[model samples]
Target: MTDSTAPRVAIVTGASGGIGRAVAERLAADGVRVVAHYSGNADAAAEVVAAITAGEGEAIAVGGDVADEAAMAALFDAAEQRFGGVDVLVHTAGIMPLGPIAELDLETFDRIQRVNVRGTFVVDQLAARRMRSGGAIINFSTSVTRLQMPTYGAYAASKGAVEAMTLILARELRGRDITVNAVAPGPTATPLFFAGKPQEVVDRIASLNPMERLGTPEDIAEVAAFLAGPGRWVNGQVLYANGGAA
Candidate 1:
């Protein structure tokens, strides 16, 4: 069991941007030491670390491909070396290149699986091995899996595998007192969500939900903060943070 008084350590993968950045900042704000992991954006990762430090929060930037086992293992090492031990793992690292199932190229599908599926597996494996007993593992999924939207088949499929892993891992950690869950965000207002999307398409998707506006990275971060801290009982499930889109 972790010492409740000690600051918890968290590794937020993909912390350079989007929901990952929000989650990293939020956790740090809540007094958790953060390992901000980025795959290719060292400058952006530094910016994340800077913002956290500027806010009087503890954070460090680490760069690695999430699918690479050796790199991810080193990330855990750094967190342990810097913050004592890890207590939370928010795995928001993933890629979403939209294409219709029938027309999508095989290369794109493979890339999605490599980053979204295998990347998740590698990170979660390390977390399971290294996290303290009273920790949590939060994986990123998407409401697209439930929305049945066209052109989202490949991305949704990758997240479906994530959902499966989240459930089984929760059960697998029965005696460890750690919680595992996935957060499925819908139509979030992130650079990734806006890329290649026309205003009309974006408006149409936003309107599908009752809120009429798109979800923000902070909105998803709120749910992540809950799971990472007080929401201990919400295990083995995928909480849809989509503003009732599905």
Candidate 2:
């Protein structure tokens, strides 16, 4: 059994890049030993671990598909074998394919829901079963769920499900002492956000927020870190880290 005084262990999904990478590093800096989960990019995940190690932090890179139950079970087993127990789960692994609801093909919409909604449910279920008391489960949602953007139908729907699951899971945990919450980021400037978008479109989305600029990966990571650590009173809610984008 893990000692109460031992450092907390966190499993950060999608830690290979973007907001996930930043969250892994930030949590490690806060003295949480990290299991950096990657979907496919092993090298990028390794880089994140190396950076954390260089800063004298503890971390490991584990690769698995978020939507696969067996694969995710293996990931949890790996973390338990290495770090004793998991105290936090920052699930940032998801896909975003943009298109109008009517125009978007059924196949693509299904893929988005599979990765985003199903993925969140799978990991959150595993975390609920395994995480220790005082643990936090932070799932990723998007501000577009409220902004109601044109090309975000599929993505928004998936995230809307995420938000709903997060809230109810917190209540279900009841006496478990784990806090469940979703971070809804708006217009974050990551490679994922830059994909398939022109400069003009990017600028317009960026300007939708009062900050008048694209949010960095670090910006979103800060919110995840809070929910993981000191934000104990914040439970069963979606915290918008969008600089007033709503």
Report model 1's TM-score to 2 decimal places.
0.99
Residue 5 accuracy (lDDT) in model 1: 93
Candidate 2 per-residue lDDT, tens place, 184-212, comes to: 99989899999989999998988998889
Model 1 — which ten-residue stretch has the worst lDDT? Answer: 1-10
lDDT of each: 0.95, 0.94
Residue 148's lDDT within candidate 1 is 90
Q: In model 2, which runs have C-alpha deviations exceeding 4 angstroms?
A: none
Candidate 1, 223: how far from true, in Å? 0.1
Predicted candidate 1 versus true structure: per-residue lDDT over 47-80, tens digit per residue: 9999999999999999999999999999999999
Residue 49 of model 1: what lDDT? 97
